[model samples]
Every structure is written in C-alpha cells, then in structure tokens.
Target: MFKIISALTLFISVSVHAQTPDSLLKPSPIKTLTTQQYNALIKGEDQYGMGLVAELNGLPSPDRALKYKKELDLSPTQVATFTKLAVELKRKKIEMGNFIVTNETKLETMFRTKKLNESDLIFYTNRYGLYQGELRNAILQASLKTWQLLSPQQVNKLLTFKKS
Candidate 1:
C-alpha cells in the first residue's frame, strides 16, 4: 500500500509539472502583411494614385487608366478619361517623391556641413508640407476610386479588415 501510494503521488507530480510543447503554447495568429506583400501593396497604391491623377488632370495614360478600370469594371471610354488623369497625377507624384528625397538630403547637408539656419528650416518645412499635400490628394483620389469599385459587401469586408 505504501509503495503504491508513493508511485501514484510521483505520477501525479510528474504529470502536473510536464511542460507543454512551445508550438502548442503559441498565441493565436495575428493578421499581418509580409514584407513582399507590403511592397506589392505599395506598388499597387502608386498605380492607383497615378490612375486617379491622370483622370483628374486630363492626360490619360492607358497603363494608369487600365489599373483602376480593370479593378472597377469601367467602360473603355471611362478608362481612357480616367487614365489620362491618373497619368498626370502619377507624374506629379513621382516629381514629389523625388523632390522630397532630394530635399531631405539638402536638409541633412545643411545641418551637417553648412550649419542650419532659420530660413533653411522654414524652406524645408514648407517643401515637406507641399509634399504632404500632394500625397494626401493622391491617397484620397485612390481611395475614392477604390470605393467606387467595391460593392457594399466588399466595402464592408474592407472596412472590417482594414488595420488602419
């Protein structure tokens, strides 16, 4: 009886102290974008931005127009008109991106090499604001186009799943 009780106690203690496998203990999966997916999404966004700008600015490029039109199931004429606007917008966006990149370096150089001044800071801030405005317009235009393409159900799904 004593030996049996000792064995039972040891068994219970060992079982109670056993560690769960790390894999089984893992938390629930979180939805997140992979690096590749993020890059693709960014590319898709630029394409969308270009499409909107071309449509709004009256300089349709077929490539830019098709990007949005294919997604939206728009007619050929609508695609053409919108593409023109998108292309123009894309051109502006490219210029803006480049300008910002260049100006960032200019600011760094001013601080590191030349010494920062009030006028330099003001100029840099103004350029940044301008770049921000251009980007904001592009994002709004793309979102508007996307909303137009998505159905009510699709929009609901998008809204529900969208992280930010």
Candidate 2:
C-alpha cells in the first residue's frame, strides 16, 4: 500500500510539473504578429480572413478570375479590365499593409519599452482598425469588380467549382 501511494504521488508531481503554463506568459517576438503573420504581411498577402468573406459570397478573387479566364471565355477587353483592377488592388493593398505594419511595429515598441498609455493605446488600436477596414474594402471591391466582368454562365460555373 505504501509503495503504491508513493508511485501515485510521484506520477501526479511529474504530471503537474510538465503541464506548467510558462508559454502563456511569454511575450511574442513581434507582439502584434506571429512569425507566419509577419512573413505573409511582408509578401503582400492577406494574413487575415478579410478577403475570404467576399470570396465565399460569390465573388472570386483576382487571381481566381485570371485562372478561370480561358474557361470563362473572357474577351481581351474583359481580361484587360481584370488586369487593371488587380494591379490597382495590389498597389492599394500593399500600401495599406505597409501602413498597418508600421503602426503595429510602433505599438509593439511602445509596449516593449513600457511606454504604453491608455490614450495612446486606444488611438493606435483605432488606427489599426481603420487600416484593416480599408484593406478589406479594397480586396472586396476588386472581387465585386471581377464579378461584374463575368457573364452569368461564368458566374454559375465559378460558383459550381467553388462548391466542389
């Protein structure tokens, strides 16, 4: 009985020690983003699901529109339109993404340096929200424009493919 109790106590102690929550208290390297997020942001890719909302709602992304161009029997003019829209969207997204990353870096620095204050925090957070909204709008508007360029049959085909 004594040996059994000792073994049980040892097992419980080891389990508790191994389950320490130290990782939860540790600060992230960038504060605002994980490594993957930082990489995606720098590459002009959407790190958030902002664009997926439009994509799922019957609006294809610029890349998808181009990919299915042959299947959709897109005319030269329609292709040119999509190309221009995509270029504009990419430029705007990159600009907005850089702004967001710069502000996030500033916020991270303030927190790391222990200089964060309530008013500054609120201001920075709101600024970040505005930038995010702008970025999402740009992507969504591109999606809408792409949808407009597609014929009704092409739209149905795209939707069917998406469902599959």
Candidate 3:
C-alpha cells in the first residue's frame, strides 16, 4: 500500500509540473492578460502587435530579465546593457507600429471603395503580409541583440530553469 501511494504521488507531481507554463519547451510567456485590456491597447494602433511580435521572436520581457539576472548570475554591468537593449527594442516596436498605421490608411481606402474585387483583395492581403514581415524582422533583430548580450552558459541556465 505504501509503494502504491508513493508512486501515485510522484506521477501526479510530475504531471502537474509538465503542464506548467514555464515548461522547458515553451518559449513564450504563458501569462494571460484580460481580453478587455488587450483590446483597448490594440484598438488605436498596431504597436501592441509589434510588441507581441517581438516577444514571439524571443525578445525577453522585463520579467524574464529579472528571472535571468539572478539565474544567469549577471553582473551590474550586464544588467545595464540589458536595460539599454530593451529600450532599443521599444523603439523598433514603435517604428513597426507606425508602419502598420501608414498601411492601414491605404487598406481602408481599398476597403471602402466599391472597386474592391479579387485583385483588390489580393492587394489588401499583400499589405498585411508586408507589415507582418517588417514586424518580424524587427523582432528578429531584437532577439539577436539579446542573444549577443547573454553568454552561452547563461542561456543554458535559462533552459534548465525553464525545465525546473
């Protein structure tokens, strides 16, 4: 009876941990923000989307920075660099957001005109493609910069922490 109880408890513990958002294989922040807040932020501009794009591309958040600063054994010097990197990323995000707004006006013009047909639809879709491509490239740049800022050993530690 003791053996059976212990085995079951171990299995349950492992299962619960596996389901956690910080699981090693998951690269994204799993925290959920309320839909109302998300909608409010995204309504006027695509800057919010740019931020998400950066995150999806592995640009670490401030929260992630705090987690890694301790885990990676970063010095004061590195922390300062990381803060600068984050600021650069924010600027890139804003640029992408502005690009989206510029494209949006063109898209809206096509949308409002009765001239919209198959070709117009194709053109409209292309605008979104361009915006997404630009956004993704900006994110990639930030991710690469962040990677350069950290040592391999620190990255390995991050992986281990995620697994734990």
Candidate 4:
C-alpha cells in the first residue's frame, strides 16, 4: 500500500511538472506570458512591442493603418490595398516564425543529443540570420507599400495616433 501511494505521488508530481511552462520555472523579470500571448508570438505578432523598423521608416504597420481608417479617410482603393498588405504581412510573419522555431528546435536538439557538427552549426546560424533578414524585409516592405499608398497628409495624420 505504501509503495502504491509513493508511485502514485511520483506520477502526479511528474505530470504536474510536465504541464508547467518552462518559462515559469526560470527566474526572469518577464516570466510566464499567457498561452494567447505565446501563440500570438508564434503567429508573428510583435508581442514584445518593438517598433524600431516602423519608427525608423516613419511608417505605420498595416494593422495600425487600418485602425484609423476613418481618421485617415482612406479611399476604397486604399482600403483594399492596406487590407491586402495586412494579410500578406500576417502570412509572412507566420511563415517566418515557423521557420525560426523549427530551426531553433533542431539546433537545440542536435546539441542536446550530441549530434552537432561545426558545418551544420554554421549553416543553421547563418540560416537564422537569413530568416531574420527575410522577416525584416517583409515587414519593411509592407510599411513601404503602406507609405507609398498614403498621401503626405494621411501619413502625417497617422503619425499623430499613439500606438495602442
């Protein structure tokens, strides 16, 4: 009976630990993002609130452009264009995020399993740079497209809205 209770306790402890997020176990100022937040990150949403690209270019992101649709007084053509840009950005973000995550996982697994090789490491690391560059390009391209579509006045008006 004691042995049975001990085994059951061990099983419950393992199950509980397995269900816990690794982030919660770590010591950090930013611990335990919710599931939705993590999923959004995976989906390529800028959960970290980094706006270096958009700020540097003086361009709003697609979703931001759409948010002030009325204030911007976007034409039908503009609406369609911005909508398309948003959709494309979303698709690209998801695609890039998946590639990064998969490669990161593979790289870690290789190290953990003692299968890592120098050439493969260099290739994967460089591949990560490419992924980051591509993702940045996609984001910048969308902003550029948005900027091109908007009139000077419209752009200035968008600049007035604080980021939500």
- Cα lDDT tens digits for candidate 1, 1-164: 99999999999998767844422344322123333323333343353343454345333333433554444456666565556656765676667655655666577678767798898899998997787577657655654664464456544443333122
- Stretches off by above 4 angstroms in model 4 are 1-38, 47-51
Task: List TM-scores for all candidates, in order.
Answer: 0.46, 0.76, 0.52, 0.74
User: Which stretches in model 2 have alpha-carbon errors above 4 Å?
Assistant: 1-29, 162-164
Candidate 2: lDDT of 24? Answer: 38
- Model 3, residue 66: C-alpha shift (Å): 4.4
lDDT of 4 by residue, 99-149 (tens): 866777678778878998999999999998898788888887888888888
**lDDT-best of 3 and 4:** 4
lDDT of each: 0.54, 0.81, 0.59, 0.78
Minimal lDDT window, size 10, model 3: 28-37
- Global Cα lDDT for candidate 4: 0.78
The candidate that wins on TM-score is 2
Better candidate by TM-score, 1 or 3: 3
Regions more than 4 Å wrong, model 1:
1-72, 142-164
TM-score leaderboard ranking: 2, 4, 3, 1
Clashes of each: 13, 0, 0, 0
Give the per-residue lDDT digits (tens) of candidate 2, residues 64-151.
8777788888889988898888888878878887788789999989988999899999999999999999989999998988988888
| lDDT, model 3, position 161 | 55
